[model samples]
Target: MAIKPRSIFEEVSETQKPVAAPGGIDAKGRGARGAIRVWLMMLFALVVVMITVGGLTRLTDSGLSITEWAPLSGSVPPLNAAQWEAEFEAYKQIPEYTEQNAGMSMAEFKVIYWWEWGHRQLGRFIGLVWGLGFAYFLVRRQIPTGWTGRLVFIGALGGLQGAIGWWMVHSGLQEGMLDVASYRLATHLGLAFVILGFIAWYTFSLGRREADLMQARRAGDAGLVTLSGVLVGFALVQILLGALVAGIDAGRNFPNWPLMTTGTGASFFPPDPFSLTPIWRNFFEDAGLVQFVHRMSGYLLMAFAVFVWWRARRSPNTQTRFGFNAMLALMVVQMVIGILTVLYSAPVQIAIVHQLTAVVLWIAILRARFLARYPIAQSIRG
Candidate 1:
């Protein structure tokens, strides 16, 4: 056989070309990420409303108005005068009514009843949204890989929160109790924040592609991540402490700032801070102690947040720095709102704003932490 002359473009060796990643489950799953994020965002808004309604319920002393946790039947409010009276009678049997709201009129009872009913109804709606959304995504095979369990976990928490809400109400129904136990209230509120935190984190993660996140993580600032994580822990503890403050009406007791005092004396501690028998009970029951702890925790949280923000100033990423800056600014705003809430004796409007601000700050800190761990890339001009 005659050999043909070698062409100028002849290959010296076989070189494999890069192949595009195949279309598969993960690719299809990613395609639906935007939709899933929107669903999650809806859940986020509903949960925020739920938390606000829950706060208003507690503030208005309406949590015990239903006096029962009839999850299925409770979705519907009384439609007639007779049914309303029956519902009022049930509430009358609870300790909250006999001890604090004796002789409350039917109209007043209706107001409180509606407050609680609306709270529960919103909860039911949230469950429906999550259930339907999750089911639709599941049936369509749109859920991202490794996300089914996470979504399920949120639903599971929501269900448990419902039970805990009833448990809290049950505490007030017990003989001689004026309100739900502060610790249990703390548990309930704490779990809400945890659920909110997870939803927020998942939302942040879904904002970027999985591969992009992995690559960005390689360039992340580990120290800033750790610092921000500590800040988140501090913020969470402050939140639980705030729940304690709300649980026992502690916020109204200390109307002064820079120093917490009671009606009794010039002492920094409220009267009978440790008067509770078990001593441990003081931490949860004593208004002075609870608010004091909340105040101190707030200070510590702010200090730590400042440090985290300061450290984040050195981050190479512009978005990451801006996130930390916003977090620090919100922390300041929240601090002011909190002081105003206390100074105003926790009025319904200001107190609710304070609580909502905490929610905002919690999410901001989480966003900062996320950025620290998986910073967004910037263009040369940025």
Candidate 2:
């Protein structure tokens, strides 16, 4: 006798049934895991937005407006004219206002103050959202075993980011410097990226069990992983260089691309890297060399991205291929933007877009690495 074919619903039901795990998560657990992953992704996107807005604040030279850090009280902006004048008076005492923005009115102060205020407000919002979501997940017991610690660690890092922001600001306030220290800027941006990467990795780790199995099956590509890691490293270095360039206003000096000047430029290489004396100075000071290094780093990053794409094109997996192509496209666009920003003396709009693109490219490469490492399984139907 011939057996009847199973209905699609039956097939799906069988597939969806929880598989016994040797200390691994079950089907019900997987649903919760997916939810957590979504929450993390959303949080990560918020962080990216914060970074973009922070870039805008920096570009507009509005980062130092508030001139004070009152984590709780600062969340509420000025409510009346008296409050506004009080805040403006505080800003006026800063060397930035006395020496650079002398005679600036309260209304003008409000423009920059609002941008800085918005940035800080966003940070607080993110903190509240994360705290509430995490607490809810914890109380519900939906948070996976061994993951709570990591979650708390990330939360602490967020707190640290707040502290670091003040520390960076303090550098400028104490020395009467108009701009923040390059090293502190690097530290701040680096931490932001680290938090971003952690969230991305956490999200990827929460994929379904079937997806984990697929990843296990295709885990022999060591070279690809290494290459991807190197690309990520390259991108990060480029970010640091860009930060330094911004800190020193280096882009203002070099308005030509592919060459330093209109015709044959000054020597392609500085006679002595030590010309900037005190190794730290070369990294943060010496505007000409800093800009030159940033430009060269961009070229290096583009070349590396292109090479990665070329190799990925030969991979059997469609996801890896797509990732490689996306990285290539992003690199090219980023390079063009970098050149344009330099040529045009880092116009605010273009500079902000450039910073935003860096975040986007960072996320894209991260996602690509994740997919390559953890290929998802196709659902089986009877």
Candidate 3:
């Protein structure tokens, strides 16, 4: 038996191929990967809810009610009359209280107070959801390779957005300032959209296995990929402009749509667009100019969307074509909602609907872009 070992050398006539790298097999197609993605998708939905609530706070003029950022303790609202008075006293110090909402009763104060508190509460909940989910996956070693950094970056952005929320509120507390600065509000909203876009992108990327994604990458369409990027940039600019419109209450000012009007007659540009001090301030503070720019940008966005849809119609992949179709339909509906929002002077219910549609439309565009980058395979049959 011991002498039989010598036969090993005789059997080694053909050298053994090196063992394949460990775990080189496609484990990416496993269920754990999909589970992590589902967690992220849940976080995405929560953030959307947070945004909608924030919009309500602003619409109800409740953004300045909290007066402070208590990341931990502020979760609980006032429980007693004395505590309520303390909160009300802090509010009274702000110009929004002394000048705009002067002499408001306690009951009225409670209404706006609840709206803002709810908004902040939702933000905290979203952060908790993201942190817990990320931490769980990270501890379990369930996060996919190259995704740890992505998840951590999202948490960092969420933290920054919270700080920015306080910063925006602080602006409105300044002497004689009735609301947050338009630029600041735009920054806050822009970053939220950025976070949202990243989530949407990661969600889309995780929908397929690594092997499939790699294979799809080989057949990627560069033209559509480039156009989708352009579309995102184009849409972001329009979104910022819309933020400006919201900040300055410009929508209420231009109640008549398709054309802006003077107090006495009709005009293309807002009359006296340069009236604000320092001329440049007009862009940020001028309602007429901001509203006019927002309207014009909406028009341009619509035109570009039409072009993207036309190109998408030529895509050979059925799923890719459908993605583009959904995006185009949402864009068109968003345009109509934008017009209606202007015509009706941005009533709370209607404006909220417009905003919700905007979130959906944004997600749709992201889906189309994801498809463009890594198109889904399709059958040849009709």
Candidate 4:
């Protein structure tokens, strides 16, 4: 065989294709992004349902029905006749039972007791789902790099939320108290949204590969990001304010729109808006004042959302723009729902619907904010 002549220049001139450093965990199929995202979506749905159920429990004045924070044994509600009477007797000691529902029949007591029991049960279920999913991912060694901490953080928050739930319930159990303190209620609800927000942001991030996210982030709109962030803050504040309103049943007291009246005449503020002693209590306990603050905050939030949507119109990404559009549209719908809720005196059905809309709007705002922070890359034709 004749030996082929090799040019000395060939060795130096030819470029070597470097190995791509084994890609990343994603390329190795270790990220489990899709599986984790599905798990998060499940958590998201459950949390939404939890929020709605919690709202119903509050509205029905059933939150204090159980009068106990039994995380483990409480799961198995009153099973027999004696057990039912025992539970009812315990509830009868609370001011809510003694002062508000004093004449509650066993059947009537059962209804509220079920509401509270179911609410707590749902919380336990959520915690279970989170724990099982987290363990599965951890045991399988499939959690993405840096994500184990995030997942653990969520679990931690869930635990803290349970504690806060008990704290809120304990408030109403105290003497002379008819309902949970408004501030405590707001704190509990606020944490729920915070947990939801983290899940949502993680879910959005996991939908794409980390490399793609890094690349797309380079093209994200800074102005829109800032604006959307501000809008998110406003939306959350409005939501907390709404919680305060619900906490005190303020919406039912102020049925007049465009003006909060004592039902006989139009007035901008509630009657004796600051009648509560110590002055500060008015912000939380005074129906007229709390509802008024919620209303004004909604107006400001709506206006800011409109401004953000207008700013989003200038973004190059179609999906990002669409997200903001949905956000603004939902904000409008939520506002209208709020008005109707007040007009109808916060009836359980209408009030629950209003609360559900707030959830949707919240997710919408978060979706838009995510798009702003990590926009999808698009061709110039887009």
Q: Which residue pairs overlap in candidate 1's backbone?
A: none
Best by TM-score: 4
Clashes of each: 0, 0, 0, 0
Relative to the unseen true structure, what is the C-alpha lDDT of residue 298 in candidate 1, on a scale of 0 to 100? 86
Per-residue accuracy of model 1 over 1-382 as CA lDDT, tens digit each: 9998999898788789988785443365574789999999999999999999999999998888887788898787899989998999998887788889999999899898889899999999999999999999999988888899999999999999999988988888899999898888889999999999999999999988888888899989999998898888888889989999999999998688877664664566567678889889889888888888898888888888888888999988999999999999999999999999989999999999999999999999999999999999888788
Which stretch of 10 consecutive residues in model 3 shows the poorest summed lDDT? 22-31
Residue runs of model 4 more than 4 Å from their true location after superposition: 1-30
For candidate 3, list the clashing residue pairs, or say none: none
Query: All candidates' lDDT scores?
Result: 0.90, 0.80, 0.87, 0.89
Off by over 4 Å in 1: 1-31, 263-265
TM accuracy, model 4: 0.94
TM-score for each candidate, following the candidate numbering: 0.93, 0.86, 0.93, 0.94
lDDT of 2 by residue, 200-241 (tens): 878777764644545554753567777888888888888988
Scored by Cα lDDT, where does model 2 land? Answer: 0.80
- Worst ten in a row by lDDT for model 4: 22-31
Worst 10 residues of 2 by lDDT: 373-382
